[model samples]
Target: MLLKLNPEHLLLIRTHAASTYPEECCGIILGYLANESKTVVEVIPTENAWSGETLEDNKRRRYAIAPEIMLKIQKEARDRSLHIIGIYHSHPDNPAIPSESDRIQAWQEYSYIIVSVPNGKAGELKSWHLDGDRQFQEEEIEIA
Candidate 1:
């Protein structure tokens, strides 16, 4: 599978990641899915809702979006005739790859976009899709 996003949408995600440097930034992706491609129609920047009590649960290494936000986005997207095709987040000072925690938290059929933020700057951007076997497979990202 692959994900298609416009330059503007990409930029928005990158900027949001950079702005939230040292912590994970997360959001929702609204788009249409056809065959093997998910074409992005909108990017919604959201707050990192995960508040872990321990250092291991810090936002710098983890992120979560509120369930209420998810419901709200779903309703808005449905009204606009779009679907929630994926979720996006930043990996501050880490590779743009899905970690074990990511895989455990992911839902099949949803694309996951990870942006690498290094030194408060957005570096590489990559997309992933969890397969039936519960493994993350790299997804092609088409920016057009």
Candidate 2:
């Protein structure tokens, strides 16, 4: 399905991704207008517990959305008459494609938006939805 993103939400994702370049950034995508059509109203960035360098492998990066933050996001979504439509994260080194680890960790109900920050710049952002067999299918995101 296609998703329409507001200007503010688009800016938030772009700024957040740019600010956290070279390290993974993460957040939640909140959706409103849920009757017959849905549109994204907000993108909330949360604290990344795993945002720093890894002792085992400096090249590899990790990030996780804490339970407390998740609860807060849920509350915010509810307050705004919205729902959790997706989860967003920046890929420091890789392209805007779902990695094996990402696929393994993604839930069936949530869309996954990957922002690729190659060369410490936000190169591209892409969205994916998991199918019945748990495989990713690309979705279009329109900024309006």
Top TM-score prediction, candidate number? 1
Backbone clashes, each candidate: 0, 0
Which parts of model 1 are misplaced by more than 4 Å? Answer: none
TM-score of each: 0.98, 0.85
Clashing pairs in 1: none
What do the candidate models score in CA lDDT, each in turn? 0.96, 0.78
**Candidate 1: C-alpha RMSD after superposition:** 0.6
Model 2 stretches with alpha carbons more than 4 Å out = 33-37, 51-60
Q: Which ten residues in a row have the lowest lDDT in candidate 2?
A: 51-60
Across 1-144, the per-residue lDDT of candidate 1 in tens digits comes to: 979999999999999999999999999999998998999999999999998888988999999999999999999999999999999999999999999999999999789999999999999999999888999999999888
Candidate 2 lDDT at 113 equals 85
